[model samples]
Target: MTLLTALLNGAVALSTAKIPAKRQSLIILILLIIASANSFLHLWFSEASEHSTNIFVTIIASGIVLSNRAHWTASILFNWVGWITISVWLELALIQHFFFAMAMSTLLSWFAHLARKKLVTKQIELEIERDLAIQHELEAKAATETKSAFLANMSHEIRTPMNGVIGMIELVSQTELNTDQKNYLATAKRSADSLLIIINDILDFSKIEVGELTIEFVEFDLEQFFEELIHDQHFHARKKGLTLALSKGDFHHRHVVGDPYRITQIMNNLLSNAIKFTESGGITVHYDLVTLGDNLQLKVEIKDTGIGVSETALPFLFDSFSQADTSTTRKFGGTGLGLSITKQLCELMNGDISVKSQLNQGSTFSFSVRLKPPRQTHKMASKPPVPVSFEGLQVLLVEDNEINQEVMLAILKGLDVNVFIANDGLEALATLSHSQRLKFDLILMDCQMPNLDGYEATRRIRAGEAGEIFSHIPIAALTANVMDSERVKCIEAGMNEYLTKPVKIEALKSVLVKYHKQAPAQH
Candidate 1:
């Protein structure tokens, strides 16, 4: 009887172990058979009637299973089996052991519940982190969009007034004046030019930040270009009492395919920096052509006898919005973006810029660019003189700002062209519709205006909504939107050309000359 009772207790202990469900069920059945035999033995044998030992063993086994398994399902099965054995043995006095087993099971279940709760909390935390990351991304995107819109609006608003001021200054400078009046005009022009530079730098930096700057390759005469560039720099050098020199090596080829506008901008920036820093010594620009196995490289170097960069500052010389130090910026007066922009442009051209400098002696900036040689040699054409008169040319100048309108009026008056003004796109269309006797030769359309924008107006004109007579009229977009995307938009809307403000007289006249040739031959 004792052996059978021990077997029953051992089976109950193994019940909560990590055995398969079927194996566990077989063990439980054996335990029940042992219990039934023990009950029969107790009924058949007087010694087996003493059930105290069996009750004690069953209670201890139940407690062991509940503590080790720590799972509510296993604990319930153990408690049910223990109670059934006790009842079948008719041991109602051992019911006290059931209460003790239930208490131990409750304690173990509480701990298991806590572990599950901790897991859930950890999962919630991860979910919150993921949500926060998405929110932050959305906020950053919104902020970037807002910044772009603000910059676009500011570009147009500020350049409109600047055009009037700069245009008036250029006109005043052309008039005959005494030495003192000429100096005054020169100073005013310089200040205005400086402001324009700041504006340009900000716009360029923004474009670079947004990855919107692009490069263009076309045929250009490098020799002629350098000659003109040096000529312009000469005036600035003379003002500082410095000599500007250019040295050219043997040229096996003359015309090459590259972005001449970007090249000129980079050279201009380097020259301007040299001039700004140098006190007395001269600036020399040297370039040579090198032939590689299958490619030609143009190596250009600019050496300036100026206050050179210190060793520590050299590393960060090309860093944006940073100068050699606070003192250099305070004395030199610049936004410290020129060299950074220059370096980036060189890299974009598949080249790189390096600098060699000594504290007080000089600095030399050199870069080499690989360019493809043109199949046919191209000679630089002599620039045609600015039109002295546009006697019979009729131009429609569409502008909303009063000051801008006045500026365009003065410029057109100098060209001796009949000028017609419109305040907005709506007015421009209305004017063209009513004017059957006098057809416009060209339209200088501003992109941003009230009632309707220049893009929409151009669309209407191209769609023949403004009458078939106006459909073929050459229209040029004039605005302060310097972005390349804006230029593409203008072209897509049927504008023949794009001009950015503040517009110069030379650029305006050049555009007229270009399209004037294509204009229908006047009767």
Candidate 2:
């Protein structure tokens, strides 16, 4: 009888545990029948031998503990103690003692299965959440990359033409013209300059959005840099018939190590806003330096006696694409990105910016940037190498665009340079490889061109494809791509210098002077 009970309970436990929960009904039913049979046999055996070893109860309990659904049913069947178990009263000869032990076994097994099921469900839910978070992060990253690429492409397309427009106009303006014609040209120039500023602002904003904006730290004369900057903005203030002055605070050091360009940008934004918003009186620029052992903090304040910001608007003044009001934007013609860019630039330099003002009285805009004294006192004590004369200097202007070529040629010619044109990289390579061609003093290579690009041409040049005589020729990238990543690529391609298009005369001249000084003496 004990063996029969063992076999029946064991079969039910094994079958139910192995079968799918949804497909375990047959197995469950068998479990119910086995529980009933076990109950009756346990009672009969208990009566036949009052000194029974309780082996039947032990076998039933083992089966209950070993199987999942079967144990759960058996637990319930034993007065809902397991999933499905028989009532002790259902036994024709119920033995209270034997039934008590069987009941206890199913109850314990049922509780264990219940706790385990809860744990498995919770684990599955956590895994699902983790997967969803990962998917979202990946999607966001892809979206940011796509936006950055789009901005880069658009910047190249737009700047390429802007380079031509501004360059050509400057060339035309240099020629003889009447006062009226000059006035028209001056207005055109101002309009072009404003347009360029807007384009630059948008590009800068895009770079900041993607965390691609890089800050460069180099030794520079801080006082001189700001002095020149204020001098430049003085014209705008003078045009408005307002006063402008700078109080150059006593400095601990004349030269400090920091990102001078970004500092200039921050100052430009604040001072421009102060000038633009002011209607009466004047603006004063104040600066001070604080020494912090290993670092220096340069603080600047721009005070303007102009229209001030409303209390409501002051909070969001530094937020991207925001201004005092929409009407303010309509009156002040700006992308509302300048202040936002300034705020971020300050933070990048481990500094901060703030403004205090009321509606009509005026506002004081203050910002600070951290720097450090040069490790060597005279690291940048000397000014940059002065540009030499452009007379008789030779340059190979490798460009595909005719309009761009015309603009570059006019500028180069104005500088009295001997300019040679190569329509594409392949042509530039062919020109240099020729034994009879003029040994070019410098190669002003354009990056993107048909047939072959400048990068490959430069690599080949460096690899002796253009003969060892010209292989060491100074190559400067003169392209429309303005991203820093693009500059890195140009350097990797063996170019020594990078200058972007709509090339400024001074900038182009600087590059020319650099290579000319180092140019191999003509044969």
Candidate 3:
């Protein structure tokens, strides 16, 4: 009986899972019949009754169920029924006990199959989830890269023309005009300036996102700084029919070192917002030195009567590209980046900012920053000389845009410099290589252009590809990209100075003064 059971089950294994459906069914049925017959026959035989049939049935049932998913139900049910059949057909002692033992074993094995199936299914789900997460991560990185490229391109395209507009407006302002004409010109200039500020806000936010903003500290008179800042904004407040003034501050110093530009930026952001929102009342500003524990901090406060923030909007006031409400954006036009930039600048300078406001009353903003104690300077700060000249200097201007070239030429002419023009980096190289009779005191190179770029041209010049005499000539990158990476890139590519586009006449003169002192005589 044992040999018959083993041989019959072995035949089912030999019929591999690939056997025809009907044939597979036939084979499993035959194993079931023979296994049951073996159980009955063994029960009659006193020697083997205890051990034979159920073991063979378990092997046959589990193997078929695991290997053939299509027939597993039949395999499980028929095998269990086969054991029950044995219990029923036999007239033996303790028949009920035999039936109960077989039923419990079959129930335990079926539960084991279900647990294994669930474990396999869960593993597959986890692997699929991991793959999808990797895909999403890759997509996010690609999107960030795309946005960066778009911003860089947009900045260049916009600033190239902006340089021409603002530069020409300044040049035109220098000429004679009637009172009304001057007023119209002032309005035009203000409009252009406002547009420039918007562009800068967008660019600044981009810089912040990429973690490339730079900060620097300069020495200035504490007394004079507040006076001048108020004076500069007086015209705007006057135009709006709002009084702008500085309240008193508790300070005992004359000269201190701090980031004056950033300080001015923070002040401008707060003051501008105040002026924009206020209809009647004036803006009051205070500068003070406060002692906070062991740290001596420079505290500034601006109070204004304006449309204040609601409780819902107060917490998110400093969030980037966010305003008090959607209506705030619609009523007052702005990119909503100024206050966010101000908050970050405060933090960058080791400070914090806060606001107190009511829905209809007004707002007061306070900022405190850590700064070094004042030190005495040898001389009081003096005003820079008006319309400084670089009369004897010679400059080679490399640029692609015609309007930008004209703008630069006009500015350089005012400085009394003898200028030469090259439309691109290659032309500049060729000019330097061939002009033995003429040498340049400085090369003002633009970063982005067709054919070749400023970085490669500067690299080649440093590598001695543009003749040895011209190789060491000063190259200043005049670009619109103000990102910190661009500055580092210029330095690494062998540039002596870096300047941004819409190049301020003051900045240009500073560049000329420093370079012309080291400039070859009349080159």
Candidate 4:
């Protein structure tokens, strides 16, 4: 009766105990519940033997204690009492029962210790992996920032020399020269322009990598865009003795809303690549429409019969600083960032790019992008006509450089316009102040001059004593600063039009005509 009562009390204690550790807590709880139910049944039934009840309780209690390191000693004491009681009840040998209980406890305790060590080791390994990932991420961010700083510094350094070269070339072209000198100057100018383009590509790639690039969508004529692109690239193709051809697809309309600058950039990169690679065969560009569900996409394809890319080099074509071959770098010089920038710009506009090539035959690059159809609103068939001549017009030319001043004078000589020259902004102000009797029609202000720059000069003229006479004068800003912010600065500085240095004759003529008609009537 005492043995049976002890078994019932042990079963209730085991059932009430809960496993605290999470790894095997649920399994431990389930085993304990099963053992408790078995013990209650054995105690309640009349046919169940006391020896069986004692043996079952001893085995379950031993397992629970052996599975946990904290309970091993207590479990052994409890199991020993149960085992002895059962052995006596069943009339079994005391030595054999004691040996069995000791062996079971030793084996279970060793197994539980081994499992606990392994669990601790796994947790340490996970912590190490997480720390390594964080370290790598930080290193990558530092490298990217370093690269951006290098690119910005390089761009500023390179552009300064390029501006000097192009400016000097413009000044030289205005001088009286033999055919040989003129031809040499033209070649040098072309090389400088190409270098400028490469520099721009590098700057653009840096902007893209740092997430500073953005697209602006504006209404533009698709046909006009194509025409301008062809005009700009045809000279390069001609110089290389390669044929350049364009095949326009049937678009049913001409005007579309898109980012003209980015589209032009992509087209220029593709066209320049094609021209650079091809030596004998021609290059061709074609476009077509793609229909996907309800959306319309445009696909532009540029194909060239050039020394094509190898199988190994094809994969890294769009990677920054990677070129097709080392010899290609020496033979066909580039910064190798054009295609990388082109691909990123396309993706920024929700488009994709692809390329296909053979070893020696040729290569074809393609891109696709969705665009809304042209609006059906009324289209102006004709633009307002510009005046054909700048004859009999009064012009002001302000420049600090003597060579540049002479160059401007020579260009304006045959235009039949009355020209006045000033060495600096202060000189320009004096000239204007003294010449109030003969009202100046147009003021061409140089942006960077001694005593006062173009911005301050324009402001002063607009706010000075000759406010009535010069305030209404159409002042055009001329400078080498071609950045978008520079353009905005010129506009905010009271200038009517902005023209970059090394100005094209046609562009200057157009500006003159634009402001001439818009200028206020004389008092």
RMSD (CA, Å), each prediction: 11.1, 6.7, 8.4, 12.0
Give lDDT: candidate 1, residue 307: 93
Using TM-score as the yardstick, the better of models 1 and 3 is 1
Candidate 3 — number of clashing residue pairs?
0
Tell me the spans in candidate 4 whose CA falls farther than 4 Å from its real position: 1-186, 202-219, 231-243, 259-261, 289-297, 347-350, 369-376, 383-388, 464-466
- Residues 1-523, model 1: lDDT tens digits: 5675577667656754567645665565556445545644453454343444443344344333322333434534554465456556665544464456545544554565455446545755886898998999888778766766677788888888889889889888878999999999989998999999889888878877766678887887779889999998999999999999999999777888888888888899999999999999899999987777666788899999999989999999999988988998888889989989888888888889999998998999998776777767657567788677887788899999888888889888888888999999999888988886677889999999999999999999888777888898899999987876788889999999888889988889998887566555632
Task: Put down candidate 3 lDDT per residue, 101-208, tens digits, no spaces.
Answer: 556655655665565446545755886899999989888778767776677778888888889998998888888999998998899889988998899888878877
TM-score of each: 0.74, 0.80, 0.72, 0.61
Q: For model 2, how does the per-residue alpha-carbon lDDT over 1-523 read when each residue is reduced to its tens digit?
A: 5554565566546543645544554455455456545554564545443322333343444344433556445434543332122233334232454556545655565665566556545755887899999999899899888887787688778998999999989998999999999999999998998898888888888888888788888888877887899999999999999999999788768888999989988988888888999988999999999898799999998999999988999999999889888898899889999999999999999999999999998999999999988878854646476554577688888999899999999888877788989999889878888844577888899888889999999999999987888888889998887776778889999999999877888888888887777665764
Decide which is better by TM-score, 1 or 2. 2
Task: Give per-residue lDDT, candidate 1, residue 109.
Answer: 45
lDDT (10s digit) by residue, model 4, range 1-523: 4544454455445433553344343344344444444443453453334434444444445443333544434444444555455446655564364465555544664565456446645755886898998888888888876765565446534654564577678768878999999999999988888877877886787778766567776667777788889889999899899998889888655666678888889999889889989898899989876555545577899999988898999999999988998999999888989899889988987899999999888899999776665456456377666555667678899877776666667666655667899888888888988887787778888887779888898988989745567876888987755444556778999998887655666778887776566444542
